[model samples]
Target: MEPLFRLEGVVVAEADGRRRIDGLSATIESGERLAVLGPSGAGKSTLLFLLNRLLDPTAGSIFFRGRPLQAYDPRELRRSVVLVPQRATAVSGTVADNVCLGRRIHRLPCPREAVAEMLAAFGLDTGLIDRDARALSGGELARVALARAVLLAPEVLLLDEATASLDPPSAEGVLRALFAGLSARGEGERTVVWVTHDWALARRLASRMWWLERGRLSRPPEGADEAGAEGETRGTAAGEGGARR
Candidate 1:
């Protein structure tokens, strides 16, 4: 199957004028669950930003479906490749209002029945649809974001620590629903690249892992001591007690 997204020699600079990502290149196959594990300040978030077109590379290029990303319109790029951020800041609106915001913005047709079903599938009460966005809890806000993103039917899904704030049960429920709904399309029609510091979560969801350290990419053995004593495999964060600079 053809790659859905390709990054070649992609580099990004930090606020202090430092090159955080130095010449990184990778191919993202359609419908593959790829986990990017890295320490704080390892450019993991920056990489996701680049993939979502929230941030452009200082150098190098990205291709979507064999076409250069630069050739595509930014608005269109976002419509096709959406990012569901970790922090849940609900847009000011009702539950159903927020859920269908994407479709409204893009002028896409959406079914009300489908919207209600998605809300229920995400463990949200249908009555909550009439409630204000700010009234929802962190987990509820997270579900709303996921539902909205999925409703857009994006070709590629970029999850940046998306489940970080949710309680264990809520997080697991959301993750299960995500994979069950999307992964059934096989490994060649959709794509998921989730960035997280949680190794256990990565192992549970990602089929392949890429480790990042100090702006460089590493494929350290899954359970190698190099990943530190997190006791979890794959992209678990190294210094959980503190953030990296």
Candidate 2:
């Protein structure tokens, strides 16, 4: 079977000649859970943007399901490849409206029951459904954004520091609900590419891992201590204040 996404010598560079992503080449298979790990400014977020057509590479090619990524309409491509950005965003409306945004975009039915179920799954009280979206906290907004994307049932889900705002226990609960919802969709129906500095969370969620550094893909240092590496990545994440290229 053809891979869901394939990149060949992909390069994303700024106008001033700094490369955000350089010579990245990889295949994302269907149903694979991929964890992308990197220090601050490692281009992890840039890679996700490219995959969903939010940003195109300055060089090389990207193919999705045997077709060049650019060949597909940007809106159409985005419907299949959804991205939950590092910063949570909410439309100006009620919580239910935000949760049903994807379906509305696709012109699908926005069933009230579905919205309630998704919110509940994300550990949100259904009573918040009618509440103003603008009043949500950072963590609440993150979960809402996640629920919005998941409700779309996109073929691929791209997450960039998605759970960063939540405490560990809350993050874990959200992840559990996320996987359960995805699993209910049936095996091989959805793929997840998660960008995270939390190594332990990545281990729990991903089937494979990729590391990026200085705008290029690379292996971890030889015999790197897992626990120490996790701490280092977490510390860097904090120092950088979640800023990424």
Candidate 3:
């Protein structure tokens, strides 16, 4: 099968002359679950940024569905490729409103039956649908964000530490919902590229894995030293990338 995404020597450098993603080359096949693994400062999130066009590369090229990344209209490309960031951003509306927001914005059909089924699949009670979104807890808000994203049924879903903020059970629930949502189209019908520090979770869900360090890919399946270590594996608040609490 043809690859869904192809990167050839992709380079992303910041304004200060630092390379966030350096000379990365790889292929992401359609319907594959790829786990992007690395320590903090490894530019894992930058790769996602490049994929979604949130940050354009300083050099090299990225092709999506056999076309240059820059070839597609931003709005149209985004409609087919969705990214769910680590932080869940819920709009100030009821749960039902939040789930239907994407379809409404896209001018698509809003099927109530499908909406209710998705809510139940994510372990969300039907009663929550009429409740205020802003009043939800961290886990509840996470599910709400996921429901909105998955309902769009994007061809590719990019998750940047999406489950890192949730409690174990909640995180597990989110994972089940996500994969269930994907498999809802039949197994391996949609592609997923997830950036996560959870090695065990990666092992469980990702069919393949990539290890990045200092903006470059390393040999995988043995990327980091510890599997369950509590560490930050993405950009830091100070803009300088480092790993720790």
Candidate 4:
């Protein structure tokens, strides 16, 4: 499969010589659900930010579909590869309004069937559509964000600690919905790059793992029980997180 994204010796640093990402190189293929793992402040977010073009590398280059990232129009690049941040912001509007924000931004007509299907796919009631977004629970907010993002059908979805703010059951629900959505999308139809600290999450959702520590990326050590990876790319074993997520 062709690489959806390729990073070559990329470096992202602060003005004071603090490097958030250092000499990183990797290839993310189409349809690959990559779980980025690491301790706190390990540059996972920074890497995702770069992938989403929120920040450019200080050196080296990043390529999308073999073309330089900067070569693509920023608005166009972002549409195909979108980032859903950790803290989702719900505009002061109805759930339908929030969910359809993408189509609005793109100036497309509102497809009501599409909206309802997405809401159901994410385990949300269609009745919630008329409800206020800010009044939704944490779990509801997370699902709303996923519903919003997936509706766009991005080729690559960059999730930066997306479900981190939810409770265990809510997080699991979100993961399961995500996996189901990917499966329904068919292989190579969509790619997901999720930054998570949960080993169980990685074990369930990722066929390949990219562990980041100290601003560098590498595969996890051999014999580590990244369970269920060989069977399915769907996250299951929902356990409470122990380490800092």
Candidate 5:
């Protein structure tokens, strides 16, 4: 399959000479759900930021559909490859207003109808439409953020700790909605790269899994349980901050 998103030798470094991502390379095909597993500081969030073009790599390049990302307008890139951050700060408006913000910025036509459909698809009630965006609970805010991102009809979705703040049930609910929405889209129309520390959730959702440590990315080690035993073990080491993610 052709890759929807590709990173080649990407690296991100700070002014203090600390490298957050080091020579990382990966490819994600359309419709693929990839789980990025690593200990805290494994550069997982940085990777998402890079995908969203929120961070420019100090070295190497990123390509979207065989075109260098640098060639695309940042606003256009983000509209096509939406990132739902771990903790989103809701804009001061009704939930519906915030969700429709994307189409407004893009000047996309018929935003109201599209926003309503998205809320329904995400299992959110219409009542939330009138609710204040900033007043929602953490989980509620997450749902709104996700709904807003989906409104963009992104080709690639970058999720950095998407469900981290949600309780288990709520998180599961959100995942179900996400998968269902993806299925409803045209074949090969979307790709998801979700970064999370939760091994169990990864096993349940990911079509493939990758592990990161010390700013490097690798496939799951040979003989490691494909169903998350490795993720749990890695979690312990991850607690020590070796990954500096």
Candidate 6:
């Protein structure tokens, strides 16, 4: 089967001749959990933007499901390949309005039950549904963003430091709920590409991991120690839980 995405000599250069991504060739398999790790300014966020066509590359080609990204309508492509950026953002309105923005955009019905369920799944209180979105805390905003993206049921989910604002325990809980939700949707139905600096979290969530540096990709160093001693076991357990779907 064809990979979900294929990049050939992809390059993204700024007007000043700075290359954010230089000759990046890669293949992202369908339904795979891919974790991209790198230092700050390694073009991690840029890569996600490229995937969903938020930005065009200066050179080379990117294919989504075997079709050139440029061939698809940007609006249509984004509905299937959703990206949640690191910063928490909310528009002027109630939480429900923000959470159901995608549905509204697609002219789909925004059922109250579905919205409530999504908020609950993300560890958010359904009561907040009527609250002003702009009044939310940073962590709450982050969870709200996540809930919004997940509710869209996108084919591919790109997360850029999505849970960075939450505390560790809260982050874990939210992620566990996320994985459960994805599993319930059915295996191989969604692909996740997460960009994070947390090695242990990456190992726990991703089936495959890659290192991006200086606009290039490479394998993570073998035998690199995880932050926590139980990281390996937790990773295994997470995979097992997902497989049970």
Q: Considering every candidate listed, which one attains the maximal TM-score?
A: 6
The candidate 6 region of ten consecutive residues with least summed lDDT is 228-237
State the lDDT of candidate 3 residue by residue for 1-245, as single tens digits.
55799999999888898998999888987866777888898999989888989889999999998899999987788877888877877787888888888778899887878778778877789788888988887777778777887988888889888877787667766776787786574334687888888766666566667888789887544435355322322221211121111
lDDT of each: 0.76, 0.83, 0.77, 0.78, 0.75, 0.82
Task: Write the residue-wise lDDT of candidate 5 on 1-245 in tens digits.
Answer: 55777899988999998889999887777766778888788888998889878989999999888888888999989988888888966878888888877767899763566677878876678767888888888777777788877766778888888778787767867876876665565445567888887767766667666788767875455644454344323322311122112
TM-score of each: 0.85, 0.89, 0.86, 0.85, 0.84, 0.90
lDDT of candidate 6 over 1-245, digit per residue (tens)? 88899999999998999999999999988877777887788899999999999999999999999999999999999999999998989989999999998878988888888889989999889999999999999999998898888887788889998999988778868876776676565345678888877777766667767688778885444555343222122234345455223
Off by over 4 Å in 6: 185-188, 219-237, 240-245
The better-scoring model by lDDT among 2 and 3 is 2
Q: Which wins on TM-score, candidate 2 or candidate 3?
A: 2
Candidate 2, residue 232: lDDT:
20
What TM-score does candidate 1 reach?
0.85
lDDT winner? 2
lDDT of 4 by residue, 91-126 (tens): 989999999887678776668777788899888899
Candidate 4: clashing pairs of residues: none
Q: lDDT rank, highest first?
A: 2, 6, 4, 3, 1, 5
Error of 3 at 220 (Å): 6.3
**Lowest lDDT 10-mer window, candidate 3?**
236-245
Error of 3 at 7 (Å): 0.6
Q: List model 2 lDDT by residue over 40-117, tens digit each.
A: 998999999999999999999999999999899998889889999999988999999999998899998888998999
lDDT of 1 by residue, 40-151 (tens): 8888888888887888899999988888888889899998788998687777888888899888999987677877977987888988878998999888888888888888
Off by over 4 Å in 2: 186-188, 222-245
Distance from true location, Cα of 39 in model 4, Å: 0.7
Error of 4 at 205 (Å): 1.6
Off by over 4 Å in 1: 183-188, 220-245
